[model samples]
Target chain A: MTPASPAEPTNPPLTRRARRRNQLVAVTGLVLVWVLLWGSFTWANLIGGLLVAVVLLTVFPLPPVTFAGRIRPVPLARFWSRFLRDLVVASVQIAWLALRFGHTPRSAIIAVPLRVNTDLNLTLTAEALSLVPGSLILEADRRTGTLYVHVLGVRTLDEVQRFRRDVLDLEARIVAAIGSSEERRRVTGADPAGPPEPTRLEGTPT
Target chain B: MTLDAVLDIVAAGCLIAGALLSLAAGVALIRFPDLLSRMHAAAKPQVLGLLLVLLGCALRLRTGVDITTLVLVGVFQLATAPVAAHMVGRVAYPHDEIRRDLLLTDELAAHIDRIRADRTDRPEVSDAASAPGRG
Candidate 1:
């Protein structure tokens, strides 16, 4: 009950400097994409790619995902290493589940209310969770900053609870890697009120 | 053996592993009972499988331009696969497509009513305009 914040974090007001930086980031990424797509980086390619990036950005405005945090090399490296390992492990588990006979895999839908309810945090957490394991993003409630994850194969209530905890843990790791300093405290300090109690259910089905 | 020969051997192994994962995904598609499960099964393996296959391809090519193209494919797949899965999963839920009996617990059910209410309350915020009969 205490996990999610009472109010969602509104998008931070962007200064002119912030807006320019965001545009610069977008332009650089897009140009790199164009160059890579062309499979060469000659002067002609560089100039052409820049033109294309500008045109594309002008035509289709991008979403305002305020990146308020700086990348920490140590934590970023940790995130990548862990992500690659989980990708392999999850693939193996899913493969085994599919190949095995007789057992019908039990699934559950778990609502994981995030600790830091920023749009950036919510989006990254959802994306990472879907990739890492038996979890899939069913729906992400932006208003409440909750992610409803459909997890494959959980035979009991304990497993369900464990998965929820894992989700929170994953969210924390994500924040550590790239969340703002203020947001990082929310993870490090954790919920001030208390540990999250199990969400009340409509009826515990047998 | 030479370096090229050893690299070729590793590349072949990656290709084989990717193929096996893809096969597993196909098997799950048929064996899984419902739309949600099948969609989940069909999509997840293919992601890692595609990455492995691309890695093999990059190793075999061993050229800058080609490797960048392979990298692009991997990047795009990583970005888009989860989004595609999410789209399918949301539609599968609250419908006959989900084998409700097989679901151990549906935490979403508790919040479904309020979610629907919000959707109807602010149709602009939702994709309700895209619903077949309405728009």
Candidate 2:
């Protein structure tokens, strides 16, 4: 029998203390990232990243804390391996393009379809993809499961086709690494090559 | 003078120019009475200003990796900012708070029928449809 779809809850509530704790964690994480990246205890960069994160959270609030659906913790070792591999691949691609194609290369904007759901997963996917040199996520239509991306140094239609396939593969690995166990079961069944199927989530078609 | 000193001077100059331009753009945002003008102010100098800042960063960094990262960031910002601004204007133009008196013509209103036909998902009252109504 097909598993019963998880029912959506409206306004998943968070305790006041939980909210404060989350904010603290977020701030701490930001400081750590800043120090790691800059290799110095620069208060300026730390504060700047914090402010940006705050603005982002204010503009886009988190999905309500729903009891029905659970987030899967990324397997740290696996996630690191895949992330590093992609980073290396992207850097090499960019370097190759710079050497061969000069600064301005023929580029196109294409939308690739994916199976991932949830704002957080989609966002993390986009950010990860964007760190790659030759490709950047322009926008993601979460409702449609499509990501608009700008790719550098494409010469022909065949290249575009390969690029599209590469994006799909990248997204699949990301989803596999980050998706909940239930999401893995649901998405693996859906054909990633085809048009997105309707989400089984209980929300009104958002 | 040492290479570091020379690099520092160039970086400082670029940083100063970038800061001034950004400051000008911020002032214009407050000073301008209309949305379009404010955007015009924002787009021109601020973008160039940001480029200068990136250049400054690249100059200051003695290592190749830092320079590469700064350049990549600059390129990404350049590519993304206009798209974001366009999207913002697309959403914001429909709002009543935008001053209509300052506009010459609202092209969105002229093409409202076509736009509505194109995007059935969006409300007819959205900024994309109301572009021409500002005049």
Candidate 3:
């Protein structure tokens, strides 16, 4: 028989206080959404939204996905700026590529090893990567913390390595911004003397 | 031009650009070779295009409620689109919908094979190992 591996719940169970807080946030969000959909903020809309929120929460609670990450201002600012820059740059590049139908750019599905292990980190990194125009996540094996990404416009091995580095850098920034202290330590400890360096693939040129 | 005129021009630009991006996504969907690549056409440009369209809506409506709603729609789209894409990708991979030739490194296939071998050696443990939830 396969040894019964320790069954770790995908999301840590929430405490009573945390549950209350989540409910409050959910209610407020629903009310705001209600007002927006109506294009007006009135007492009736607010009350209706609150009622709906309560009913929804009671009837169908969200799956127990833990929200454990905390925001670090400096790293978050850096991450946002980088993300926005990449957004614009990638959009333009993909748009241009698509319009130039004369030449078919080479594309490939490459595996990316992720150092960040938490569910939140994995989700955020995958989402961020997919949002960028040229790259999309083809498969995420949480079992191995590996992401298979389909990337456009990669014609050379150098470009592949560059893509890998970019992904690792993105993960590091995410770990810096919101990762738990242990995660932060692991990231920094990997490169003790200087900034966290991306793991280089063997045989890839420096 | 007056400030109102400027806002109108900017909003018009956003709307036009967003429409064009959506058009590109459609074209790519048709032209791309396989399921995996076709997904690239289906997802990326569509989200950005929706975002641009939302921005234009916010600019044109200029009311607090409308702007708030538009922003929320964009946020929810940003949060959900990738997840949907991921789910589709996951299903496609196992079903062999992917064109194997386009892959440079298929770590997933190797990983699955290794797990399968391990399971075959110890049949009793295979159920838990193959289950969808994390280990």
Candidate 4:
């Protein structure tokens, strides 16, 4: 087990003022997500991503790892940009689906085996997948750390493969964004220096 | 576009959508035979539909304490809905059998005794059961 970060704050020590700010940040993120869904606007998406990042950083008090200090902000500028690009690409694909098929599109549950094992990263990946419109996280297995997503439309295996690729890419970006090196190591079963292997973890991309 | 007109359209849409979803929830609750099934119906559409209605109302009455109250109502519902369902499930646990078709594995069946003990200690039957008894 990785050691907890030295800088990680213990739960009981959260001060009232800090808690209040945290609550405020959480609420703001909620409002932003609500607005984004309501409007489906790109600007709102950017704002929501930043707001969520801030909430995760400030409000989500990471537990001390067995070895690593508290997980804090890693400079993931490239990761964020990549995620945004994926978001745009997925959004366009969803929009195309909406426009091309008015209502009677076939949908199926695709099993997506995740590369990341951390529960937090899994959840974030699920949430992000769901946000990509026309995809919903139907069920997740923490034991095997796989996710089943119901894709709005599916007609071919190639489409499924693409969906799997995009989702894994998204998960990788999220892991890079928020996870500690120890967490990554635990997930990939590799030393921090080694490349993440393509494990049995795969998703049924619709 | 007139802001008032835009707000009016949104408000109307919210109210309609909320009412429709709440109606669906009511139908589901009434149609489904068991407590868990009823809970399945009650949880999502009812909460979301009511929230939509509340949002619509809040949009219409955007200026004052009404919005705050709506927010409070939304929060209260968000917080309480799951808790109430949990309590109901716990109460109905022992006697409330599941349909074979619906359940894959009765995980809760293993801890039936513990659930019954908890209910016996509290014994606060929900109004749902009472209404059915009256009927």
Second chain alone, TM-score for each candidate: 0.85, 0.78, 0.80, 0.79
- For candidate 3, give the docking quality class from DockQ: acceptable
- Regions more than 4 Å wrong, model 2: A1-75, A101-104, A190-206, B1-135
How well does each candidate superpose onto the true structure, as a TM-score?
0.92, 0.43, 0.78, 0.41
Cα lDDT for residue B17, candidate 4: 77
Each model's TM-score for chain A is: 0.92, 0.58, 0.76, 0.51
**How far in Å is the alpha carbon of B59 misplaced in model 1?**
0.5
Question: Which pairs in model 1 have colliding backbones?
Answer: none
Best by TM-score: 1
Error of 3 at B64 (Å): 2.9
The total number of steric clashes, by the backbone 3 Å criterion, in model 3 comes to 1
Instruction: Count the clashes in each prediction.
Output: 0, 2, 1, 22
Worst 10 residues of 4 chain A by lDDT: A1-10
Model 1, total clashes: 0
* Model 2 iRMSD vs. native: 16.7
TM-score of 3: 0.78
DockQ of each: 0.40, 0.04, 0.31, 0.04
lDDT of 1 at B94: 82
The RMSD (Cα, Å) of candidate 1 is: 4.6
Note the residue pairs that clash in candidate 2.
Answer: B106-B132, B109-B132
Ranking by lDDT: 1, 3, 2, 4
- TM-score pick, better of 3 and 4: 3
Cα displacement (Å) at residue B29, model 3: 1.5
